[model samples]
Target: MSRRPYKPVMSKTWYLKQPSYRNYMIREMSSVFIGLWTLNLLIGLGKLIQGPATWSQWLALQAHPLMILFSAVTLALALYHSLTWFRAVPQVMRIQIGTSFVPAKLITNAHIGAMVGFSAIVLLATLWGV
Candidate 1:
């Protein structure tokens, strides 16, 4: 009989065992969707560059229910990624103004406010075609 070397068994669901690990995994995985969305945007830009008809076709493709669902999911994941990263800024970096350190909640809230403001501006500009 041949003796086989002993190998440690690793469970596939090990990350799910801890909430922190699961959340970390989720935050990390969200980047994949973000990257996909970026690629999609780039492709759409390329289509626009090709011609107005090409861009219209691309827009029509995006109107499909499946693409709409994918976009929604990707948007949600991107939001999650942004929230987690912005919230972690205080913990990862110490910001001091004079003798007092800035609060993490304040920093996170400021970032969230900035994001909303910028998004609103972009939406309005896009709608106004400016």
Candidate 2:
């Protein structure tokens, strides 16, 4: 195999300049996002347990214009993170069936299907309130 000398790509923009830098940035940013999301869930549990008054405060917080906007942003970020993760999941937990590689599309579709089903369940549960 012939090898070529490595050449570095230089760019004025910090993140776009290096692939490694961009990947590291993504990793760090995702960790922070995941952490914040978990904390948000914990806050939700607190609001639930602290009685309807505290829960009403939480609901009011959710009703705030800023919170609504940030919730959308959070959903977008989570969707991106989940897509990246689901795409790589087949490779991580690869199944062997007579030494053939699994198609990535199948994994993606399965993930999408599961998400849709889960969403439906959550919606129904919320509506029924049982």
Candidate 3:
């Protein structure tokens, strides 16, 4: 194999049409951003699992004003991501319940219902079933 010098030659037109350029910049941007926030969530979980002291420390950190502000932003973005994921479940897995073809919207709504129900269960458990 002959060795060739790597030239830093660039062309705007070619880069514009490059699939990597489009995929890297546009299609995967939000996924990457959410991936970052997901990492944060995992780290938070890890800290919480360390023990009550660590978990309380993390909770106090969250109550700080700036953290609270960013938490609000990430919360909204996460909700948007969750809804998008839930909406795609029906498309990804078509359900045939019993003898009829269930609609995609109905399946998506069921997914949303399950999510809400799970949240309610947690809330009720926290409240000691009052």
**Local accuracy of candidate 3 as per-residue lDDT tens digits, 37-119:** 67867878999889999988888887899877776766666666667778778878887879887899998899899988998
> Which segments of candidate 2 are over 4 A away from where they belong?
1-14, 18-28
RMSD of 1: 3.8
Q: Scored by CA lDDT, what does every candidate get?
A: 0.92, 0.78, 0.76
Sorted on TM-score, highest at the top, how do the candidates line up? 1, 2, 3
In model 1, residue pairs whose N, Cα or C atoms come closer than 3 Å (at least 3 residues apart or on different chains), thus clashing, are: none
lDDT of 2 by residue, 1-130 (tens): 5598788976667886779677656755776776776787799889999899988888888889987877777777777677677776887876667889668788777997898799899999999995
Please report the candidate that would top TM-score against the real structure.
1
In model 3, what are the clashing residue pairs, if there are any?
none
| TM-score of each model, in listed order | 0.85, 0.69, 0.56
Error of 2 at 108 (Å): 2.6
**Candidate 2, run of 10 with poorest lDDT:** 23-32
Question: Per-residue CA lDDT of candidate 1, range 44-129, in tens?
Answer: 99999999999999999999999899899998988888888888888988889999999889999999899999999999999999
After superposition on all CA atoms, what RMSD does each candidate show versus the true structure? 3.8, 5.8, 6.5
Worst 10 residues of 3 by lDDT: 22-31
Q: Give the TM-score of candidate 2.
A: 0.69
